[model samples]
Target: ICNTVYRRIPLRGVCTKCGGNLTLTVHERSIKKYLEISKMLTEKYDLPGYARQRIKLVEKSIESLFTNDKVKVTKLSDFL
Candidate 1:
């Protein structure tokens, strides 16, 4: 699963999972949105246990998508 996700990332460019082109800013926003949703789902709300578990997977995927860089220009895939 990690291999598939890693391969899906462009080496030095931006593209959606479907190979659709995306601006760097757009991709960053998309990832941030997912991260927020996952965080909310994990909170002690009215959500089911299973739902929170699934959202954790989404969070993990987002983690793999990028590195710990403050500036988002250097993609993690570039080091792959």
Candidate 2:
């Protein structure tokens, strides 16, 4: 049984008759975007020749909330 209520999806559901490719949809695009931006920001904002691994660890938190399209994030606060 799948519960979309809590956005709970089983990774792979077994088929009754014959087991087949049961793919689980994950939010991979978000992951990619976060990884890309963190790299860009850490380089630009932080000190030169700094610890990249540490930067990545710090970036994980910021990535969680940065979901909107980049332009859209800037536009909403402009409403007056």
Candidate 3:
């Protein structure tokens, strides 16, 4: 499941189950925008709950980027 989610999140031009090709450029841009929004929120607000969720999401996005590049993470915990 981790591997599947890893692949789905980051890699561009991967094949879909229905034989279609998936691309990451658009998705990456979208995630980046969300990250920026999250960052801005963090800067402007003191809401711990909202900040925590955004932080987790940004971390996941970073993890996906690293995984997409075939970085050899020794353990899932390390990735986390």
Candidate 4:
């Protein structure tokens, strides 16, 4: 997916809006693929403390990467 996106990118190195969205979706899916299974296995197998900690770190990193950083505000009257 990334390779395809890279090829489609312009020489200036900026991806088109579509390409950027595709790349983000691909990355998000791939990152989340094994997360649940990894945590389940870690618990089932009684993995070492470090291994568990590493998985937690990865989860945090993934969350940060995929989460929207922007904050949106609405007028208080809108809720009335």
Best by lDDT: 4
lDDT of each: 0.64, 0.58, 0.61, 0.75
Off by over 4 Å in 4: 1-27, 71-80
Candidate 4 collision pairs: none
Estimated TM-score for each candidate: 0.41, 0.35, 0.38, 0.56
lDDT of 1 by residue, 40-69 (tens): 756847688888777888777677776665
Q: Which candidate leads in TM-score?
A: 4
Candidate scoring better on TM-score of 1 and 4: 4
> Which of the two, 3 or 4, has more lDDT?
4
List the pairs of residues colliding in candidate 3: none
Give Cα distance to truth, residue 53, candidate 3, Å: 5.5
- lDDT by residue (1-80, candidate 2, tens digit) is 33233245344555333454344555657667767786887778875655687766656655654555555544666985
Among residues 3 or more apart in sequence or in different chains, the pairs in candidate 1 whose N, CA or C atoms overlap within 3 Å are none
TM-score for candidate 1, residues paired by index? 0.41
lDDT of 4 by residue, 10-55 (tens): 6544455444434323578776879988999999999999999999
Full ranking by TM-score: 4, 1, 3, 2
Candidates 1 and 2, the one with greater TM-score: 1
Candidate 2 weakest ten by summed lDDT:
1-10
Clashes of each: 0, 0, 0, 0
Would you list the rank order by lDDT, best first? Answer: 4, 1, 3, 2
Task: Write one digit per residue (lDDT tens) for candidate 3, span 1-80.
Answer: 11232334434444434435444344566566777787777778866786678687777867578466655549878879
